[model samples]
Target: MDSGLGEGSSGYSTMDDYESLISTTDAELLKRAWRNEKAAPQILRYEAALVQRSREQIKLMEETVEEFTSSGVDPLTVSLYQMDLDRTLFLLRSYLRVRLQKIEKYMFHIRKTTELWNHLSRAEQNFAERCIEDMEQHMQQSVLSKLPSSYKSHLKQSSSSEEDDMVPEPKLDTYVICRSKKFLGAFQLDDRQFLSIQCHLLSWRMNSFIFLMSMNFWTVLKTLLTLKLMIYTLYLISL
Candidate 1:
């Protein structure tokens, strides 16, 4: 979620919903993080605390599985526990793998961009640095070595280039399909422009309005009965 946006309203409606969300298991949190990372066009903020807790949980589960195996616990129970452990491991691994893929794909752009670079975890930052070093060396040997000195720079097409035009950056202008949990009416794009966004699936440019799609800002209000009824109808149709 974009920390820059003010907390207009929470996605959760009641104390019970908030409690339920906060009480979610680390495994579930990891799954959500994994899905979000996969769907996002650019890299997302690292879930450092959630990842650490998940790792600790995995270690404990591994030890428990080993003990259960040695003690000859019920076969079905042990198998179920093993399955849960495997699923959690897969989620964590997949999440990290997706981040690594994004880092690799945009290593040069990420390193040069402060906001994107700061979003990475320390380990991911190290990985990106190493990746940049390796890529530069490889480019020099395999491609840049044969080019003239003016075109030898890894991040530029030529020495005369104004910027790192050769670097691969994420496509912020790309349109994305997103859904909001709550109805946010008449979002202003500029001083004279506004867009009405009821609770529905929307297609918009990622660069222009990503903050509106943040889960944290999907706030609910009780003031729009007509809109609520329409949304309820849409939900029923969807079901």
Candidate 2:
């Protein structure tokens, strides 16, 4: 499938061939995404249109990969789709990572805001701290939940590689999570006071951001999910 089952294979461009294989809507979505343009149904917000476009492309690509695999395409072809999807996912994940870093900064800001607020003499400080905690919790919840279910579940399933199938091994590192739990024990703040807010004001700003990223979050780059998607697509194609 990479070169092909053929006499004309030497003349073909892989990019062009694969482009044709893509669904027209997927192609349009991708084209617009790359162009970073605003277009129809306004399915994506103007600021996030490109990201949504890219995500739509991947979703459609996943569907196409499924169709190919199910049709009994050779492993080589499957490999191409896999690699293409992998690359796109890599980009998507990279974008998410960048956003996550921003979220991290904002989280720090939320803490810092209150930390500074805590330094104030009296009523103002308490009011600010309460606001900050409420904002932080809301921001965390919104970002965490907004990620696509299909993309998220797919990632969880595809955590390992085909190469790893060669050996039996413990799946996760024990220390990281354990250490995190320990860290949580050290921070003492009001839990309910942490939650309640009059308007959810500051957090709503963060919510807007999470809303934007949710439309474009890159869980697709996760190899495990990619593999699972491929296998599922293959099944669909076969049907």
Candidate 3:
């Protein structure tokens, strides 16, 4: 692997360094974003690079899996590689989704801040535009849109209201509930069932804690009794 380092230093040994560099870059971008700086351009650039790298990695892993299969490598080893590819794709998708979510959440501010838009690089502006369009299309196709007609009507009314000065930022609890619903649905469980399981788990944990504490209490009591007996025996011997 080239590691994208200088030619003299390009080797597998530098891959870790390259990873650290990318991680550091991401951290800096996130910090800027947290401070509400015009970091969209940098974020878009980083996102593009990461997406490209993920695609290349996925392709390479697929090729490697094919070669291993052809060479009659153990099924377990090939499966592990397949799992890695799956995880890579999952992470890539998650990364893009989160970026889009943030962009969407802050779209109102982005639009009103002329300086922010001006600060964006041409590539970043393009990415932002395309991302907005894609997010709208996705929402149209998503389960959210398929929700009850009443919900759809409510959304339409809220969106068309002219009196609203700005889009309200999503509540943290709402975001958490949305994510939790998706997570539960992934395992074919509803919120009620998930809650039941959570309660059961909590109860089990409490019971286990009580049992351990009781055992510890008995151990301490026994130790104290033994020490008292030894003290009494020592007094008798001294007498």
Best candidate, TM-score:
1
Q: Cα lDDT for residue 118, model 3?
A: 60
What order do you get sorting by TM-score, best first?
1, 3, 2
lDDT of 3 by residue, 101-193 (tens): 555665544444565456444655676687667755776688447876544432244445654343443221110000110001112222332
- The lDDT values for all models are 0.65, 0.36, 0.42
TM-score (all chains, Cα) for each model: 0.70, 0.29, 0.36
Which sections of candidate 1 miss by over 4 Å?
Answer: 1-23, 180-239
Collision pairs in model 1 = none
1 versus 2: better lDDT goes to: 1
Clashing pairs in 2: 66-233, 70-234, 70-238, 154-225, 158-224, 158-225
Residue-wise lDDT of candidate 2 within 127-150, one digit each (tens)?
445655675477547653566553
Residue 180 CA displacement from its true place in model 1, Å? 4.3
The lowest-lDDT stretch of 10 consecutive residues in candidate 2 is: 174-183
What's model 1's TM-score? 0.70
Clashing residue pair totals per candidate (backbone < 3 A): 0, 6, 0
